[model samples]
Target: MSLRLAPSSKPSTAGSASVFDTSNSYGLHDTMRFGMRQIASEVTAKHPLENRLAEWENTQDELKMNLARNMYGMHAPIKMAMERSLVIKARGPSMLPRSSNLGLDILVGKDETIDFEDFLNVPELSTDMVDVHTVMEHQLGIRV
Candidate 1:
């Protein structure tokens, strides 16, 4: 024969202490206030590159390193392989957009035809593409 233990008859207030106390007993408001004060003190006591600012500095350093690597052709082989893989993957059979003569006539005059070559030859189109390429290159440190 075995005996079973009885459950406690005390009131259930397990998670109530941390959630709804405006008196600052165990709520998040006090914790956030303390953390903000600590961060402010540290910022005031140290150089600009201390603590959280160090993280930003480290990120900038990493971006500079990646830029140097790309400039020196260290990532060229991997980049080329990835480009080739993407090209091969995209060349697989896929549905092409249906050609609607009415839509084409509306877009380009009935006497004129719009093709990829004609699109590329458009000055405004080329300028927009160049602007996008320039911005991306500036951000990524790699020419498109």
Candidate 2:
């Protein structure tokens, strides 16, 4: 997940070093050694980065669930006002962008097309914009 440059070395005191010499076996060996250490520490070792990523993922899921719950609650009053109404459904956030989906039920007889841009302008909802895009693609049946 990262690229690191090899540490620079001091120029040789003798005439052994050349400006055009691109082949530095010692430098290559040192770079490989550094790479091995990096891999051992980051990939093989028990690092906290993975744990932090998991925690962040859980928090995102919780936020998405909260948003969905609030949206469902908001729909309750409108549901009671009329027998049926336009419903906008958004799924909770997921690890994969394509996993999140939205279901919008247009049951009202309205002449104008209601844009959801205004309603979904909230920061919490916009955080998972990829989810929205996925849902819209699913609804519209447009293959990416």
Candidate 3:
């Protein structure tokens, strides 16, 4: 396999790591060339199978989260035990509000005339609550 080596921009000292410098052993170039080739191949190639597997894993994770939320409240002692376990393991500082993690594009305006992009991009909070009915009107408005 062909490997290209760019000329060094800096002088090599006894402590420095430079391939072109003659201060180091000549055999170092072969080792560096092999390492560079391995890294190049890893960076450029994408395996489709890995992408598919990751997508499947993400879907399964969402299903598991939904299942936990649905079932935990339905039962009594099981939910209590789960809460206790979670409490014991939770040693980190308190998390930030959910609004901090939300994306800008997720917000919906109360009417079509309102600019949703400008509403969402506001740095400060506008209101505590939202009306879904006002945001989404009856489907009868459209003939189709």
Candidate 4:
């Protein structure tokens, strides 16, 4: 049988308190925060190792390329091409004859500097040029 108690008629003077005490909840929150921070630190610790490895690999590759370039002279094809393009070609002998008399040239209004454009249009060999084989056979008496 359940026991039943009668209600008290006297008024109580004590202040009412909550069934669940939330006054000390801040300590639990702090503990949880600290645990999460520790986990986060541990998780991120491995990233630096991977990042460092990648950086080291890049540095090594760069060093190897530089070493190869130093050991072998002009090994790069593009560099060679650039150097070749930058080189100034030596000019060939002038086809036109020069006069010994400076006074005659000055009177004729002929400038000392030859115009390269004038000879550019001219053919290297004359129109009446003979074949090499014919000249060799006729002059040297050599049989083909």
Candidate 5:
């Protein structure tokens, strides 16, 4: 979206100038138009934190799956031990804050343990986050 402001003595046949001041009447059409465009631009510019957050989430999922497979003895003992150590270190006391969910206190212990089954069982949790339709629209830039 683009906003342009041009002074004119009278409205053009093509389209009306966004803002105009005639006599004592002060128009703010251009200001509002530009403001909306600026807002959209700001929203679309993803923050550094968002990129980092997506990376961290991907890493966490990979680690969780590796740990789960190791715990079930699907992997070799040496590999299982390494995965267990990594899981323990990742869940250490100092890492508790990093595991916490903003506006949602779901962790249960100093170990930062959270039962995935129990968490998924919560009706509120299932409905609270962004829905698939909302995510699709946001990704596709389709505004209703």
Candidate 6:
């Protein structure tokens, strides 16, 4: 190996890392003669450049994720959870007089409707005045 000195724009001082008067004790060498392409190549990387290595690792992770997604798709429970989240998100005005959340209705698992009590904060119904048709349908699973 030959001793090589790399010139710097900054002046070296006793406090600084570089030494101006002698061959650097550190194994620093000029690699410009080897060409940038030679150093950039992965097959014979002169030194493992950290920035390039990190970029390559990120690209590899992305490729693996895409491949897995394309082959097996999202897991069933995760897909369901995502769909549920989307359903709960606020939607713009659809059919008016329609309450999307249903306030108390949605919590009770009612779909596509707003109950009498839910329409503009009507007072809660008394226990003695339940709808006979809804009660029968709920209990017997058949509409009168």
Q: Which candidate tops lDDT?
A: 5
Query: Candidate 4's C-alpha lDDT?
Result: 0.40
For model 5, residues 1-144, the per-residue Cα lDDT tens digits are: 112122232323232222332112354345543332233432454565554554554455455555556567556544645655665455432222344342232221224555673456555445345466776677689998
Find the number of clashing residue pairs for candidate 4: 0
Expressed as tens digits, the lDDT of each residue in 108-139 for candidate 1 is 23436566744566554343344555665676
In candidate 4, what are the lDDT values of residues 12-94, reduced to their tens digit?
A: 21322222321246433243323222334324334434545545534444454455466675475345434434432323223
Give me the displacement of residue 95 in model 2, in angstroms. 24
How much is the lDDT of residue 143 in candidate 6?
57
What lDDT tens digits, residue by residue, belong to model 6 across residues 1-144? 111122222332332222222223564432342322222232432333544453553444345445545667857435544555665675632322333444433432365656565555533433334555676576677854
Sorted by lDDT (best first), the order is 5, 6, 1, 2, 3, 4
Predictions: Cα RMSD each: 23.7, 20.0, 19.6, 38.3, 22.4, 23.0
Global lDDT scores for all candidate models: 0.42, 0.42, 0.40, 0.40, 0.43, 0.42
Candidate 3 wrongly placed segments (more than 4 Å): 1-43, 67-144
* Model 3 agreement with the true structure over 1-144: per-residue lDDT tens digits: 112122223322333334454233644445543333234433544465554554553444345445555766546435544654664454432232234322222221123345564368553434334444543343235332
Clashing pairs in 5: none
Candidate 4 regions off by >4 Å?
A: 1-48, 76-144
lDDT of candidate model 5 versus the reference: 0.43
Q: Which model is ahead, 1 or 3, in terms of lDDT?
A: 1
Task: Indicate the worst ten consecutive residues by lDDT in candidate 4.
Answer: 13-22
* lDDT agreement of model 3 with the native: 0.40
* 127 Cα displacement, candidate 4 (Å): 68
